[model samples]
Every structure is written in structure tokens, then in C-alpha cells.
Target: MYGTAAHNTYAQNNVGIESPTRLIEMLYEGVLRFNAQAKKSIKDGDIEKKVYWINRSIAIITELLITLDKTQGDISLYLEGLYNYEITLLTNASVDGDVAKIDEVSNVFKGLLEAWRESTNVA
Candidate 1:
């Protein structure tokens, strides 16, 4: 009975069960979803929604960078000013309701994600 109850709790929480690759994949998918929503919001002429998703995407990217830095030892230099560039783009896109900057940063992240996945054998 104890074993069965423990298993039930584990299943409920799904903690300590997910693979790291799965975690990264989920983050990637979330960022992609945010970008898609941003595009849709732009098409619908909703500046607020666009900004919302763009901000969300930037937040995710920031988290990813943090994770990478923790695991990889100061990769901010490898990014080579890209982080600042993305922040500027994010700021401009949020202020101007323009999606071009957001898309550019999203593409940059997509490339980074792909490269990281490949290097980590998670792809």
C-alpha cells in the first residue's frame, strides 16, 4: 500500500521523472508558441497581445540563457553582443508594435536552440 501511494504521488507531480531533453524541448516549444502568438496578434492588429507574447518570448530566452550559463560557463560571450541586440529589438518591438525585431530575435533563438540540441545530443 505504501509503495502504491508513493507511485501515485510521483505520477501526480511528475517530478524527478522528466528527462532534461524533454525539459529543453518543452521550453523550445513554448518559445515557438509565443512567437506564433505574437505573429497572430500582429496580424489581428492587437499591439498589446503582440507585446505580451514578445515579452514572454524574451523572458523565456532570458531563462534559457541563464540555464546555459549555469551549465556551460559564461556563454554570454559566445553570444557576442546578441543578447543586447535582442533586448534592443524587444524594446523597440514592444514600443512600436512592430514584429520584425521580435521575429529576428526568435530566429536567433531558434538557431541557438538547434545548435544546443545538436551539441547535447538532444536533437
Candidate 2:
């Protein structure tokens, strides 16, 4: 409980200090991490762990979808579709224990993360 509270406080502080672009990058990183854990859990035959990680990935994607600016026109729409697709893929991976599905979603997130990093001129 203490560790969880400390972690939450750390996360809150980081979020408070981060720029918008950095926050988005962090979100992508988080989804990637969750997907990796989900894949590993599936490999280890740990269904509960797999579900937990995949659900986390899905939640992040959903958050991204919710926060999209509709005024951005085609870009926002495209992102919404992509995020929804990722959520679907993650849900399927959780249900079917499909490592390949997790891999696919992770690869998509990797590409997005790299693109975001390049756009933000972040190392």
C-alpha cells in the first residue's frame, strides 16, 4: 500500500511537470510496457497477469481516444481509429492469449512513439 501510494505520487508529480508532448510520449511508453508484460504473462501461462497488463494497455489507449482534439480534423480522426483498433487488438489478445496480437499492437505503439519523439525533437 505504501509503495503504491509512493508510485502514484511520483506519477502525479511527473505528470504535473511534463509538457503535453512529453506526456503523450509517456502514454505511448506505458502502453508499450503493458503490452510487453501481457505477452510475457501469456507465455508464462499466467492468465490473471495477462489480463491485468492487457487491460492496462487498453485503458491507456482509451484515454488517448478520449483526449483527442476533434478540431484537429483528419489527424484526430485517424488517431481515434488507430487507438480503437489497438484496444480491440489488446482485448482479443487478453481473451485468446495471443502473443502475436500483443506483438502487433506493441509494434504499432513503437512506431507511434518513434514518430512522436521525432516530432517533439526528443532524444
Candidate 3:
């Protein structure tokens, strides 16, 4: 338990020291992970888990959307649209129990994550 607490603190500190790009990359990774869990929950017939994980993904996407610099012009607008679309997809997936929607969102996030990693030169 003590080791786990120490690890958590270390992880938090590491994140605090990361560049802004890396932080965004982390958010993308988080959304991807949550979406995967949501997909698995659906496959396992765990409705509660499905909703929880999908909601988690949506929340992260919301955070990303809110953090966007609208003053950045076209790119920010484009990202806002994409993030909104992903949130809609996630909401519909949760309501309809649609695995395909989750897959679609996951793919979108994966692409974004890849782009971020490439741009930031993050492993």
C-alpha cells in the first residue's frame, strides 16, 4: 500500500513536470484507454462499467475541448468540432450500447494521439 502511494505521488510529480504537448498526449492516451475499457465492458455485458468508462472518456474529451485556444484560428475550430463529435458519439454509444461507435471514437483518438506523439517527438 505504501509503495502504491509512493508510485502515485511519483506519477503525479512526473506529469506536473511534463510539457504542455505531453500533457495533451497523456489526455489522448487516457481517452483511448477508457474507450477500450468501455468497449470491453460492453462485450462482457457489464452495463454499469460500460457507462462509467464511456463517461470517463467523454469527460477527458470535454477537458480537451475546454483547453483549446480558440484564438489559434482554424486548427482550434477544427479540433473543437472533432472533440464535440467524439463526445456525441460516446453519448450515443452509451445510450445505444453500440460497440461500433466506441470503435470509431477510439480510432479517431488513436489518430490524434499518433499525431501528437509525432509532433512532440514523445515516445
Predicted candidate 3 versus true structure: per-residue lDDT over 1-123, tens digit per residue: 999999999989999999898899889999999999999999999999999999999999999999999999999999999999999999999999999999999999999999888877886
lDDT scores of the candidates, listed in order: 0.75, 0.93, 0.95
In terms of TM-score, which candidate is stronger, 1 or 2? 2
lDDT ranking from best to worst? 3, 2, 1
Indicate the residue-level lDDT of 88 in model 1.
Answer: 73
Residue 85 in model 1: shift from native, Å?
Answer: 2.6
Task: Report the alpha-carbon TM-score of model 1 versus the true structure.
Answer: 0.69
How does each model score on TM-score?
0.69, 0.97, 0.90
The deviation in Å at residue 113 for candidate 3 is 1.0
lDDT of 1 by residue, 39-84 (tens): 7898899988888888887786676666665445456566635765
| Backbone clashes under 3 angstroms, per model | 0, 0, 0
lDDT of 2 by residue, 1-123 (tens): 999999999999989999998899999999999988998999999999999999999999999999999999999999999999989888888889999999999999999999998888986
State the lDDT at 46 in candidate 3: 98
